[model samples]
Target: MAKETYQSLQAQIRKLQEKAETVRLKQRQPIVASILRSMQEYSITLDELKAAQAKGVSGRKRSVGTAKPAAKAPARQVAPKYRHPETGETWTGRGKPPRWLVAAEGAGATRDQFLIAQ
Candidate 1:
């Protein structure tokens, strides 16, 4: 009888140990995941710093023509109208222009000229 009790107690202890280990693992999972995410963010930041340093070392040189493009003035507070001369399509400048507009302006379209009067 004593031997049987001892064996049963040992089995219970083993099950308890397993349960404790599982609980500990569950508690640690979030901390491990957060650490991995932080590491990835740090690596990204480091890569960006390296890129900025490289750009700094290479002196600014315009790939295009010698004439430096004129600096763009800040967007007007009030919405302006915009019209495409070629397409005759009109749009109210309620918000910032899309990437296509900037690319078009870079390609030599007079953006300000297209701006609709308030």
Candidate 2:
């Protein structure tokens, strides 16, 4: 009887350990995702700041010919692929632009224009 009780206790301990590990993993996943999102946001902001600085420096160059007003930087365009805004479903059909592209077109942008032009 004592041996049986010891075996049962061991099994319960093992099960508890497994449950604890699962709970720990569940708790960690959101933290990992949040960290990744923050990193991405920081990276994007850094890139934008760099681009703005470069543009400012370029604008200060002296020109000799007929001075043209600084041309607006082109928008950043992505591939002609379409992805759903909510589900991120990428469209693989023949020449079907992404949903974002469609929305931009609807907003009076030319077809194939990117959300951000450089």
In terms of TM-score, the best-performing candidate is 2
Give lDDT tens digits, candidate 2, residues 1-118.
3556888889999999999999999999999898669869777465665676667753565567989878899976645344444555554434656666677678887633332222
Model 1 C-alpha lDDT per residue in residues 1-118, reported as the tens digit of each score: 3556888889999999999999999999999888668869776465665676668743664446688767999976644378766666665665677655677889997778777666
lDDT score, candidate 1: 0.73
Question: For candidate 2, what is the TM-score?
Answer: 0.33
TM-scores for candidates 1 onward, in order: 0.33, 0.33
Pick by lDDT: which candidate is best? 1
Worst ten in a row by lDDT for model 1: 56-65
**Which ranges of candidate 2 are over 4 A from the true structure?**
1-4, 44-118
Worst 10 residues of 2 by lDDT: 109-118
Candidate 1 Cα outliers beyond 4 Å, as residue runs: 1-4, 44-118
